[model samples]
Target: MQDEVDAVQRILSALADVGLDSITFVAEMSSTGRSVLHLLTFGPAVEAGIGPYPGSLILVEGAVPEPWRRRPHPVPRAAPAASVDAALLERTLRERIPDATGATEAEIAAAEAWLGVALPDELKALYRVTRGRWQDWGDDYAAAERVAQAVGCELFPLDELYVASALSRPCPWRFAATEAVVSPPDAAVQGLVGSPGWIVFGDNGGGDRIAVDLTPGPRGHVGQIIMLDHEQNIGASLLADSLTNLVVHQRGDRQSSYRVDQPTAVARVNIQSMTSIQAAAHPGLEVLSIGVWDGEPLSLAPVTGLPRLRTLTAYPGTLADPLEIAKLSGLEYLELGPEEWRVLLDAGAVPRTLSAAGIEVHGNRHPLPIVALANELLALWDRPPISQTILEGHVEV
Candidate 1:
């Protein structure tokens, strides 16, 4: 593990030398007990390839690989773009509200100075295109624009950063009551505890503020984008690894490979949007599925009170320990990602109770529509599979 970590750091250092900062490295132990490193980069991985390293390394740029790519699952389509460039930002803004402008370099610099922190490279590049302001510059013009009409302002002005950092004023729109939590304010002194090094960038048009971490937290790294929802008390929850990844998520470019179904009252619950409070509300859930993407590991502790939970499906990494699921006495089925499934299978640590129920491994199959697969799985459950002995005996009879 030490050797793998050293190798990864060397690779990152080499890439940084070549001016590549937007990247994510994940090192996992393979079924063979060898460390396998996966590199996710906004730019070309080929360009940052500093080879002659140990173990297997897969580099993915722009889009997800074939196996992991969300297949057959229909998602909102976004315009084609290699990376989060000025053109893509402009196009996204234009498609929603024509004539939307970006922030100027001076405005960006000013905001940085006011906040006492340098903006990330992706954000700096974005603001260099234009200074977010109105063309008409009047009440009528502001009222006419769709973004202003929807979000109360076309874009968060550079001046707002000053108010947000110093006074910690209320954010715009629905988040008007929510205070902007930035780095300058000492977490210990202010009694404002949660993310110690977050800088609010803009609002998501809802009550949530889109912020980035200047200081790395346990959940995410520095420059990693997080969603701050004061209303829900969700502070600096990992939204994406970087601005580029956030753009991809916003555009619905990255889709979940697994299929999902609408919420029903059959004790089978979809906890994609479920919060800790909401989890407590649904005490009758028999089966729970949590959709975890590239974010912090979600806590299953919230659902410990669910007495009837039989099946739990989520990314294995999300749990501190797979045994945590055993806390739910009734839990039967354990569905996990393909990689995780292999690891557990090799370790032979799968719980005896869970093994008695069944263990379903997701992935390693052709892309199937989620809805179709759900219906098929349900149908199979409704009428259990016949044993070969029964069929052979019937044929002889």
Candidate 2:
């Protein structure tokens, strides 16, 4: 350990010879071992991770970018009927691929029991005509292709069916706070991360999943088809009004119910944007991002009482009074500089409502003080503090 520390000191000493104070080293770790390391990157360190500064401490655990803990929204109404007959949908698949294999009644019942949710009649009927398990087709690509061509999707076998619960879609609080779950009264699908009523039936072959939505929006049928988009963290789009409709290969487009109802969900204050906080302030503002500015630092007074405000990110030195952040009782994400955070921590003004936070570091600054400030913020939520190890060594040079 001593030898390794001494080696780090020697390398850092050589890098410091370039005369830049904040030549930071960033090492981002991941469970997948895709961890990245920038050997001698310049600038202040805002991210949390492990990086040693020669004789000083290594940056440890960073704050969680966002925490996910949202539950599925309750569905008060029963699912409406599919637009077509289950029996007809079954026959259509049989006629399209008469030689295809299907799931047994006992197998179907077992699937329902396993999932703890009853399979909709149309899905059950479709599977009865063509069970899409890979083992059923062996290594025969033609069989799978035939099934996909018949069902308009790569179908999941009865045993593989699952409930698309909200927890299955992990989203960070920072990004989730900005999502608006608004379904038009006539909409066919509810805009949500996932629903207990959603039963996975197949895939779009492009990573998106096809599910039978039991919790329909105001105008949707109970067994309508919905697509759980892979790229989206929340919400599904309507593909068909019914399972039978989906089997017929007559697709319909349905969009996610997530929309920015108000124009000010996110406000950017900079020379090219809103230009001032006063102009950015709105009753419905959810995020306030203060970027680089040539003018004087701005005050948070204009947006203090914003009921919906949850995210505030001010560039270092851009806020005239950082303490005013305390007035924001609804903040979920807050990002500021080391000095601003110190002011907040010293005054005990950090908002308790925050679920995630960030630090904005600019120019060249040592990371130890920044790490100290980050640890303090993390401690506010009883989050694991970034550990530090101090190493003392003199450069041989």
Candidate 3:
């Protein structure tokens, strides 16, 4: 690892020699026989299927990843349950694991006090049967497996129970801005990265979490079991109506599935998605990403004056007029090539409305100009500038 770090320092030093402070490496599964982690899985992977912190983390230091900055748009909870059949749930667990020991009433109350919310009676009943700690089962794998099978998930301990706060799941800016939280009118589970009301109490064997949904969707029952997929950065799926249903019935509808490809919410004017910016234009469009184009440079006139367009990411030389970006009044995030940024900076056309921006460096570009441009954008917001630490040394390849 130290050798690898040294090599990176050497590369960065070489880049600095060419007036560059940072670079983003591309990932591919092509001619090279060697396999490296790319936009696909190898081991632990980014939920968005992108290389971690893609588009260069080096220069974006002062900028916080968008996820930590994101606020969950308000989601009104459905009415609470009149009551839960705690006795039935307790009977069911005892039948499944006859020797299981449960959490004390005091322990459960302590958890509620720590989380600042009363847990449903159904959840409390489950804990009363088995605390679900490894220590409770000791080194007996069979005992642990029996409990997991009985509960339909590997349960978290009473002390470990936590509110799956949305702030807990932070993603890079490029990805966080692209996702949308969707809970259909008839859905049982609400789509969100995290929620204070989601009392996470178990795991689905994989990294995905199993939680008791205190804030359910319009059609949902309070205290329904939900699974938050680890591979996804947002939302969850309905697993069961309650803990009793999960253990006894072993069935739960994976109720909600969210897709982010809304022409009104997100538009990709590129060869990979749609063909033209003109086609992507709409009043409700919030993000406009323009990618590789070999034909004529496109005009931003198609999307000008769009009230909801808050993000615009254009590839190098894709914009016919970078100044056209200024016409986008609601833009909070903008990413452009150095040349395009230079155009905006030179004309004093940089939007004062922006909260965060990124510089897209393509090819063997000099870092000096990009660093300078990054500083200029940071200065606009009184943000701390990107600082480069110089290291001079010869690294053995």
Q: Model 1: runs farther than 4 Å from truth?
A: 1-98, 134-137, 140-154, 162-196, 232-234, 248-397
Best by TM-score: 3
Q: Please provide, for model 2 over 203-280, each residue's C-alpha lDDT reduced to its tens digit, 9 standing for 90 to 100.
A: 989999999988888777788889999988767888888877777756656666555554646688998888888898
Ranking of candidates on TM-score, top first: 3, 2, 1
Q: How much is the lDDT of residue 144 in candidate 1?
A: 43
Greater TM-score among 2 and 3 belongs to 3
Q: What is the lDDT of residue 12 in candidate 2?
A: 76
TM-score of predicted structure 2: 0.75
Where does candidate 3 stray beyond 4 Å?
Answer: 1-84, 259-264, 391-397
* Residues forming the 10-long window of minimal summed lDDT in candidate 3: 40-49
TM-score of each: 0.31, 0.75, 0.78
lDDT of candidate 1 at residue 126, scale 0 to 100: 42
Residue 259 displacement in candidate 1 (angstroms):
24
When 1 and 3 are scored with TM-score, the better candidate is 3
Q: Tell me the alpha-carbon RMSD of every candidate.
A: 21.8, 9.0, 7.9
Clash numbers, per candidate:
6, 3, 4
What local distance difference test score does each model get? 0.42, 0.72, 0.72
